[model samples]
Target: MASSTSHQNSLPLPIFSGENYDFWSIKMKTYFMSQDLWDIVDKGFTTTENPSVEQLRQERKEKQRDANALYAIQQAVDDANFSRIMGASTAKEAWDWLKEEFQGTAKVRSIKLQTMRRELENLKMKDSEIIKDYYSRLKGVVNQLRAYGENISETRVVEKILISLTEKYDPVVTAIENSSDISQLSVTELIGSLEAFEKDWVAGMILH
Candidate 1:
């Protein structure tokens, strides 16, 4: 049976660089789901021996769809990545190839995670850096840890922010520490209060 939907307009977003695999994976998943073709990409179709005519036709269509999706994905990536997965026979094969290429071996990923943990533990907001910039740097490290499969809690992030900020923020940090439970505080809430204090402090300095 022919598919009710047309896939002629289905276009892949772009090739994913190895470093931003998580973001690229999200876009690719959404694109596949939108085109009603994720199943082929996720699980390749197998042909059965002595199949009926209808079954053979269905299998052929499945292969064609998989090929199209694979091409779309291939178009968006760099030459090196393209060359790596160019020999894949199906969309699932290509997907697996990309995953392994970006994620590397378990031992390598473990080492990467350990390094990120050390960076997070030793993170300190530079004296010249603003609150927003510091927060972004902190979040980047946290997100990388997550991409590597470690689970970081909101409280842990909040604690890091409070302790690592510069001495000028000491009064605000002390206030927050005394008034609120650091373990229960969200990073969002902590940032909001600190940013407000920052604005006021800046305004006071300008007036002086």
Candidate 2:
């Protein structure tokens, strides 16, 4: 088997941070699955009481996979989180530990929820900010809210846009609400329509 240490040393990105755990988790899981190490982390390797030669070889493969998985995980976390999982004997153990540390606690969830709620409430589309930039900011907050287990619907997001945007967006908002089913509209479509209006508005200004 290839040395897991080599793979660990060449991480494409830096370790995960608490604030970006949701994105980091998805990326890391994809990496593990691509490398075929996720199986060891998902279902531990079992060995027979009296192993045959082939069984021993299989056991060795499982052990190597576990080691590689652990190494990959260690590279994706900070020293503090590393310390929490350092004592884990298998990749599954380390994975479970990290999940619990980051996701299992109500305290963590509450803190994350509070922070996202505050950001959403205060979110505004700045006059200088382009439509794409403004929508990106809103989408980011919504994604974070979902990551923390909040069920934020598209209608709520549309409402946020209507309430938070500047006067320039008011006409677009009115047209959208009056002409379209807000609940049926995806956030992407809403952003695209508003961006089109912004382009027209800019063109009109240039012509004048």
Q: Model 2 — TM-score against the truth?
A: 0.67
lDDT of 1: 0.84
- Scored against the true structure, residue 146 in model 2 reaches a CA lDDT of 82
Model 1: CA > 4 A from native = 1-12, 17-19, 33-65, 181-185, 206-208
Quote the RMSD, in angstroms, for model 2: 4.5
- Give one digit per residue, the lDDT tens place, for model 2 in 82-140: 88888998889988887777776777778879988999999998989998888889999
Q: Residue 11 of model 2: what lDDT?
A: 58
Give the TM-score of each candidate.
Answer: 0.76, 0.67
With a 3 Å backbone cut-off (N, CA, C), the pairs that clash in candidate 2 are none
Judged by TM-score, which candidate is best? Answer: 1
Poorest 10 consecutive residues by lDDT, candidate 1: 1-10
Q: Pick the candidate with the highest lDDT.
A: 1
Q: Which segments of candidate 2 are over 4 A away from where they belong? A: 1-19, 31-68, 75-84, 96-104
